[model samples]
Target: MEWRGRRQSSNIEDRRAEGPVGGGFGGSGPGGGFRIPVGSGRGGGLSIGTIIFLVVIYFVFKAMGIDLLQVVSGGQPTPAGYERSAQESSPGEEDTKAFVATVLAETEDTWNGIFKANGETYREPRLVLFRNAIQSACGNASAASGPFYCPADQKVYLDMSFFDELSQRFKASGDFAQAYVVAHEVGHHVQNLLGILPKVNEQRQNMSEAQSNQMSVRTELQADCFAGIWGKYTQQKGLLEQGDLEEALNAATQIGDDTLQRRTQGYVVPESFNHGTSQQRSTWFKRGFDSGQLSACDTFNNPV
Candidate 1:
């Protein structure tokens, strides 16, 4: 939480000013761009009656891989109306940015040491900042998709607005919770470095949907454990304060697929869960925190 004076990672890609760059499959325009007809109500779009509803639905559909623009245009990317613009970051946002960079640097230090201990060198991954949307080697992403690490590009993508949603919507406030998010994504980078992500993804091709979801759960749980490992490292360095662990645990609970599904849909589907349950998430995180050993994060071999 107290990360103001800490080191910041230089591996940050400040693409916020770049807007959404194009480059996805079957898209058109100069930069492969596209646009969703907002409540402009122009050209037979929805009326103002369900403007807010439609906006929410749009993002939800986008998250579920239903690109409205692509669907409407038959896979043609439309040009952006506005030019690339950069907004001046507020003081709080600037501090948050610095905090993210600091957390990333610490993860780099921790993982580098960990890899060196195992006779390997850790290759640091870049963290990208963007607004609205960003294109990754894996695919195009919107902020609604949440933070993610793309192994294909060896980069982590984040939208800081998620922090506000974390605090206000999920009720998982606190600097530690924010740190946990960054650490969890970085954990994916670690898995990529170790070739675990590629192997698991390759195997998923042969798995049924349910079985693949189970594999994804294991992978996600391991990443949670890895984040806990970072927490353990910070705790050992006397960086953790009171209530920090609770913040992280609360965050894990709030973001559990079951918890989120229940909150949004008033129901839970266990088999559809790609991430673990709330208990599993918190438990695996605690396992790594208490043990502070990479061996303790073997969610695959062990009963998770």
Candidate 2:
């Protein structure tokens, strides 16, 4: 992709130097004066006062419909609203940052135009660059969680190290592949803006785990389609080169739930799939690329 010299986004927050921010409820601190006492006894059991304090806190959060344990476990909770790299400041790292910003800017341009045509204003979401771990409005996350869009914060969190993992571990390499990752997260931002995310989340509340996973698959596939829409626009702008499309398709295939599971666990669990199969991912993306229309990207109400 001929992305250099193009506009770069000003919404990037480079938090790599800040290291991992405080996580958990109340910013990873000792929750004011509610510290859990360390016992010197045989099992290092909690003292009565500590246990009582924890119980009170648990009930308090529960009353507010928040699961304290899940939050403590780094689980992303549903938003109440209607909604990072290890390397130093080297030239290579700087180039990656620039590439990400350019890709983000491209997404902004594409979505802004698309939304304007539909008589809706698009609110650009910020992208946070971090290393190791960072605290988000949704919850705490590490580099291992990959890139994610938090609806509660309307931001995309990314660790550049994931690009290395994508190339080495997933065996999907290319500048366009990296762009696909950024575009996919931005797609989630689009979903949030259109109120699709909050609505799907509301519906997921009544769904079983398997059913919810199915919904998640559809949601992710739609985002892939949206990313493809961006690809279509980028191509029309004469930025894409030969084999660029294949690079992105290979990326979608490499990270598919079935492919990842088979590689990691030597088997595929159909019901546990949340991001769709490899074929479905590539197919949906191609559908969007071919049509370049939002109506063609609807994963729901159509057989995906």
Candidate 3:
């Protein structure tokens, strides 16, 4: 994406290449203590995650009179030392930081335009660039947690090296692909502003595991569609070069929950899924791309 001249968002916090991993995320912010796991995070590198979504599910459902043990079978906790701070960046790391900053700026602009078009004000989401691990209002998380949005904090967390997972592991590479990931998280921020996230979470609390996963798939697919909205605006402003859309589409397919689950675990279980399948992801994104209208991206009202 051609993001050079855009306005960089002040909401971005440059925590990318600093501090060791594994510090306490609890009480790290003002007026905290809200326990919720916004999304299922991928562990970056070797650092394990201390607070997984299952724990969050357990605690969140405890409040709703649901036993998490019934739904969350078992998964090993992320190893210790996973929470340590990240090492200092090398000399060339500045370029990567700038790229991420530029991406944030683009998302800010695109979303701002979108909000204005709908006659509503935009509430920018903060982007936290951390090292191995960082503390959030939702919980303490490691880079292994990959990128996630904490609705409680209204912030987006990312460890840029996930680009590696995107490129080397998932085989989805290119600058635009990386930018797609950022846009997707910002899309969640959009959902939060639209009051879609809280309601979905509430509904999920009373749902069976299969039902909750279905809701999550809808949520994730909508975010993908939102990301497509951002892409449409950017492309209109002359950001598209040949293959840019393919890069983004590849990214959407690469991160599909079903695809990730099949690779991370042994097989795919539709009912246990959080993010949608690759086909659903690709389809929703294309829906948003084809029709740049935000309303067109409603995965909840219309089945995906």
Cα deviation of 30, candidate 1, in Å = 22
lDDT by residue for model 1 (1-304), tens: 6787888999999887766333222221111111110111113656677887867876677666565655565654434343344456577877888999999999998999999999999999999987757788777777656788888778888878888988898888999999999899898888888888888988989999999889989999999999999999999988898999999999998888778777776778899888788898889888889988999998889999
**What residue runs in model 2 are displaced by over 4 Å at the alpha carbon?**
20-88
Top candidate (lDDT): 2
As for TM-score, the candidate ahead, 1 or 3, is 1
Superposed by TM-score, candidate 3 places the C-alpha of residue 107 at a distance from the truth, in angstroms, of 1.5
- lDDT value, residue 5 of candidate 3: 64
Clash tally, candidates in order: 2, 2, 14
Q: Looking at candidate 3, what is the lDDT of residue 3?
A: 59
How far is each candidate from the true structure, as Cα RMSD in Å?
9.1, 11.8, 10.6
Off by over 4 Å in 1: 20-87
- lDDT scores of the candidates, listed in order: 0.79, 0.80, 0.74
Q: What digit string (tens of lDDT, one per residue) describes model 3 on residues 70-166?
A: 3344533433223223344655555666777887888888888878988999988888887666778788776556678888889888867677777
My TM-score estimates for the predictions, one after another, are: 0.81, 0.79, 0.77
Give stretches of model 3 more than 4 Å off: 21-88
- Looking at model 2, the pairs that clash are 84-130, 84-159
